[model samples]
Target: MSLECVHMPISPKNLLVVSHRYRSFQKDPIDLVSPYFDNVYVLVRFNKFADVSKYVHIPALQPFISSSKIDYTNKPLNLEVYKTSMFNLPLDSQYKKLGKLHLSVVEKIIGENNLNFDLIHSHFIWSAGYVGAKLKEKYNVPFIVTAHGYDVYDLPFKDDEWRSKIEYVLNSADAIITVSNSNRECIKKLDVKTPVTVIPNGYRQDLFYPSDTFKCRKSLDLPIDKKIILSVGNLEELKGHKYLIEAMDYLLRIRKDTICFIIGEGKLESRLNKQIKLAGLEKNVKLVGGKPHNEIPLWMNACDVFVLPSLKESFGVVQVEAMACGKPVVATRNGGSEEIIVSKDYGLICDPARPKELAENISLSLDKSWDSKKIDSYVSQFSLSVICNRILDIYDSVLSN
Candidate 1:
């Protein structure tokens, strides 16, 4: 499987990117680099919401994604995929083993299509980075791994066995990229010697910018009389939605006009719904199913404030998106929030999972007068175009060696 093509790229060359998610509600790391590579091959681990049986039988790379539905304006990407359920019995010990299948699929595809890529870039450390490490070892090609949050902060500390796997992948990568400064600190603690770069996730200013709040509320049919407190993320335990729901009582006590909306879908919908009833927040809190990605900006524009009370967040892009729309944010002291709310000027950061603290922070944010133009300007430096070029520069640096 040794790919012997060693001619340096005087021009744009092929790039093989391995990741678990893509082109969804949020901006993807691949979205920044795809346009720079001549022909990009994306291998997605089909672990998104649905049952494993949904896309198991389909031929791999059968145009699973429609062209017209692309979230951003980027060059075409050759979308390829594989299922997590195909080998899904022992979910714990088998995920890393499943990564080998990605290599097998890529090798087979290359043999049939006569294709060769200059480098391999992977997203997370566990599955995609492990797969990329194997490819780099077998083919002698460059390998780069970008740690988002969970992989670097949580997974490595799971157990000795997990630590070994993470170390193997880290040792294999030529350069490591993280989205936040705190994420880089986590990497440093791991004693990793690989060249690491901290590249914060950028906001799409085109899709998310300050608009007339009243107009935005009218378009979304949101009540203008009440102050809208918004939290957007998948309704999972990690997101700390229950805590937010609990805070509704305190929030309502202070500002009875405030109503909170939780947007995004997950398995915890029914549980959250039940919690809403038990807490007697039925009238105040709402669990609206997954909002369309395009409509997220409208929610930001319409709401008085945005909140992300996650117990653990790697890099919360929605917080920045809300800021881009000139909305004040109330975030917990999670990994990325420490940097996102670095100054009181951007937003407020309080203790995580504490309903009272969260309630107080939300109240403070609601009362504060924010300058939308300042928040917009603060987030503009992390625009998608700037992030894309930063990645391309990294690619150039890695390839020259």
Candidate 2:
């Protein structure tokens, strides 16, 4: 395929993005990248609530762009393709199947829409990267990939075939990016030739800043006097909630007044509840399901400490939010957390699967004193504007090449 370069007077080379599960416009990189581009379009596979177009805020932004949805509910394709199944199957199985589906979908989009995208920016390497590579083969357009953790860590274990698919995307994408340097190293271990960049997940700090702790606690019906510990992630085994519950067992042994809140729903919710009961921590720990993203900073401010004990992570965004709210954090050494947490300065790092260590770290984060201003200052490195500008530079370098 002969790739044609298109120069735009007002915007970036027309870009097409593919994200199977774009939470909302607030949670999208495409939205951040849109300002740096001429026209941007995102194609999402399946939106269960028919909410992708409604909740995602791309339509509001001008500059000649559109958001389109594709129906895959009844399609012969596997539903789990391009979706996270919470560390159940080997990571590679999900990636391989997802790669195949991605190729098929991209072909359909190009043919049906008569599209002319100068560059393809895929959100994840599993489905989007694979599809982007295939599109590059057909359209000859350069494509860039974003690796959001699990796609690199969980997939290659015990499955060589699936690992190859990841390698293909990593090596082929014009520029590769992950949420952290830890993840960049993981990709390097795969011997990928493409340039890989470490871009920590960025957020709109203006919207996600800290609020008055007293008012937030009162609004949430949480006790004002007791110290609160917050954790936000899908309730799954890899999230290591079991370890968090076990940590609570230790916290209560010393400070009986502490309360731990685990937010976000998942299949392991029932099992996590059972573990909580077994630990005799009914009063100390509570499992609260997922809440809107906008309401998270309030939860952060209301808590004294934020704990993220994931067995694996690309980058833990919740930890950033906590730090941004001037709250201390206790996270695991795995993946991105090791790079994000500023050691004993901002948060403590312990083994996520080890209950005793997790407990000790959580207690330390809550009881100890770290300069809140320092923690907040460290978090400013990951501000949306900083990361977005870096991303734009990467895009510019790719286009110039």
Candidate number with greatest lDDT: 1
Per residue, candidate 1 scores C-alpha lDDT tens digits across 1-401 of: 11111223336678877776556422354654555567777665543323432455222222222321234444355534323323333366666566666566656666666667889988888678988998898888899998988899988888877788888899889999889888887787775779899887777666888899999999999998998999998767789999999888888888788999998766677788898998889889998766667788899999999999999888898999899888889999888888877788889898888999899989988889998889888887676667666777788888889
- Tell me the spans in candidate 2 whose CA falls farther than 4 Å from its real position: 1-12, 24-26, 47-95
Every model's TM-score = 0.88, 0.83
lDDT for position 148 in model 2:
85
Clash pairs, candidate 2, are 12-37, 12-38, 91-155, 92-155
* TM-score, prediction 2: 0.83
**What's model 2's overall lDDT?**
0.72
lDDT of 2 by residue, 80-158 (tens): 1232112112244453565665567566766776766788888877777788888888788888988887788766543
For model 1, the run of ten residues with the poorest summed lDDT: 59-68
**Candidate 1 backbone overlaps, count:** 0
Q: C-alpha displacement of 319 in model 1, angstroms? A: 0.5
How far off is residue 208 in model 1, in Å?
1.0
Q: Rate the local accuracy (lDDT) of all candidates.
A: 0.76, 0.72
